[model samples]
Target: MTALTTLGLGPLIPLGEALPPPEVAWRLALVGVGMGLHGGPTQALVLGAAPPGRAATAASTLQLSRPLGFALGPVPAAAVWGLAGQAHGVRAGIAFAATAAGPAVPLLTLRRQPSTTAG
Candidate 1:
């Protein structure tokens, strides 16, 4: 669900160019909603799945990855934008972002195995 919402962002962003200010604002708000829906469940899943004694490490790693992803995500997008040329740069970059989300779809289908340790 979260991946699908994120996948929608790339196509939605470019539409802002042709949309009025109010329309763009609402779409951006929707993006925020999508992000909010993903964040908590993701954190919970990570924390819940951590080894019994490694919750702190799992949490810290998760925190670190968020910023790293944010910082690194644009690198490829920018490269795509540059390669595409100014005329279509923004759209190409956004399209690249959409493609990047593709892998998450399959990943989301994975189920966590039941813990072998007895309570």
Candidate 2:
């Protein structure tokens, strides 16, 4: 889902005035839906896989990566955008995101186990 969204977004950037406003709106809407679907399950999986005793810490640590990525991502993206120029910047950014996301997909496949009570 994440990979698809990242890949889908690149071409959408260049659609511009070629697409009807309604069609563009729907495509962006689908991307948002894909993001939301991906986000919730990923969070649950990360938290569920954590050591029971340290689950809270694990969740907190997991949450930290997001803002850190946001803080760090734009600098390099901006560099690529500046170098690539407006006509191609969006495609470069999309390619960068997809490449970064590719490896993480394999790591995300974790088998679920039945819950164990600590008491």
Candidate 3:
């Protein structure tokens, strides 16, 4: 169930572009559920791996990277969007995003060493 829901977000842009307004509106209801299933696990993995009492701080740091990456990640794609068009831009953007995801994944997949208390 969760994996299916998570995977459904894979088609967000193309589905939105393909469907009529009514269908898009109806499918919009499923968007949150799908994203929650996908993103919740991701966020949990980030927060869960943080040290006690400092988890929130660390999570903030992790989330900060998100917006920072938005600026950093899509520069080339945005330039392409300006010069080329949305379709090419979006394709480039996705490829860039996937490349970014590749490096962070290994970092996040480290063995769960027990977190030491600061006290």
lDDT (tens digit, per residue) of candidate 2 on 1-119:
66555555555656633567775677667656666677678788888788789899988887898668658966776677678886777667655655665666666675868788899
Instruction: Give lDDT tens digits, candidate 3, residues 1-119.
Output: 23333233334335422456675554445544643454656678778877689998978887887568557755764565456465465444434433444454455457687867898
Distance from true location, Cα of 101 in model 3, Å: 3.5
Write model 1 residue lDDT over 1-119, tens digit each, in one string.
55645655555556623657675566557556766677677788899889879999999998999779879988998899889896777678767877776677678668799768778
Please list all clashing residue pairs in model 3, or write none if there are none.
none
Regions more than 4 Å wrong, model 2: 13-24, 110-119
Give lDDT per model, in order: 0.73, 0.68, 0.54
Instruction: Give the clashing residue pairs of candidate 2, or none.
Output: none
Q: Which ten residues in a row have the lowest lDDT in candidate 1?
A: 8-17
- Between prediction 1 and prediction 2, the one with superior lDDT is 1
User: What is the TM-score of candidate 2?
Assistant: 0.65
Off by over 4 Å in 3: 1-38, 78-97, 103-110, 115-119
- RMSD of every candidate to native, in Å, equals 3.2, 4.8, 6.0
- lDDT, model 3, position 102: 47
lDDT of 3: 0.54
How high is the lDDT of residue 80 in model 1? 93
